[model samples]
Target: MTAKRIENGLMGLAAFLLLALMAVTGIDVIGRYLFNAPLSGAFELTELLLGALVFVALPLVSRAGAHVEVDLLVSVVPRAVSRVMGRMAAIVSAVVLAFFAWRLAVLGITQVTDGARSVSMGVPLAPFAFLGALTCLVAALFGLMREMRP
Candidate 1:
């Protein structure tokens, strides 16, 4: 899929996840305050949900040019050099993303092998790790395309 499409999907996923988090958190708070009973897994649930939300939204933010860029040299350089530097940065970012994805994949595999599950929800952690890694791969592909484009 195109970078823009991926960005849109990521944004949508993040938004949905954010809404879910809000609902869960709100429910947890209400239960504790009103019922005098708290959710046993509230902390773990929030941590995992927020973590997923952060990772899901990261690439979309990066694609939207929301990430910080330090262009001290690129800003001062000639046009030709600036463009070359931009391409180089894109290439490097892609490489970094690739490495991240690979590592995440390995970690996910281990999680699955170990049969690891979240403390609160009891859902397998591997799926989320894999999804996060998939997003990293998508972002890397986007970066490569950005570099290859005119």
Candidate 2:
């Protein structure tokens, strides 16, 4: 699939996740305060959704070059040097993210092997780890592409 198609799909998923998170939180709060009964496993659901949402958005953020940056050195250096520094930073970020993806993949495998799950909800943790790993890999690719851009 095209990059734009992938990005649009991710964006749609992120939007759905955000809406779900909001709905869950709102329902839980209303239920707790008004009915004295919070939704069961609301916290666990929120935790999982939040984790997924962040990873889902990571590639979008990377593609948009929206990551936070400290420009202290870049601000002082000459334009050419600053450009080089930016490229170097992107390369470094790609490397670090790739390493993170590898570690997450390993963790996912271990979780699957161990039959790991969330405490309250017994939700499988492997899928979340794999999602995180996949997103990090995509974000790392975006970082590498950032270095390629003029």
lDDT tens string, model 1, 25-99? 888899999998887788888888898997897677556656688878976889988888878888898889888
Minimal lDDT window, size 10, model 1: 58-67
Q: For model 2, what is the alpha-carbon lDDT of residue 2? A: 72
State the lDDT of candidate 2 residue by residue for 1-150, as single tens digits.
776887899999999999999999999999999999999999999999999999999999998989998888876889999988888888898889989899999999999999999999899999999999999999988777866777
Can you tell me which runs of candidate 1 are displaced by over 4 Å?
none
**TM-score for candidate 2, residues paired by index:** 0.94
Q: Give the TM-score of candidate 1.
A: 0.90
Candidate 2: lDDT of 78?
97
Query: Local distance difference test, per candidate?
Result: 0.82, 0.92
Model 1 clash tally? 0
Residue pairs clashing, model 1: none
Error of 2 at 130 (Å): 0.2
Clashing pairs in 2: none
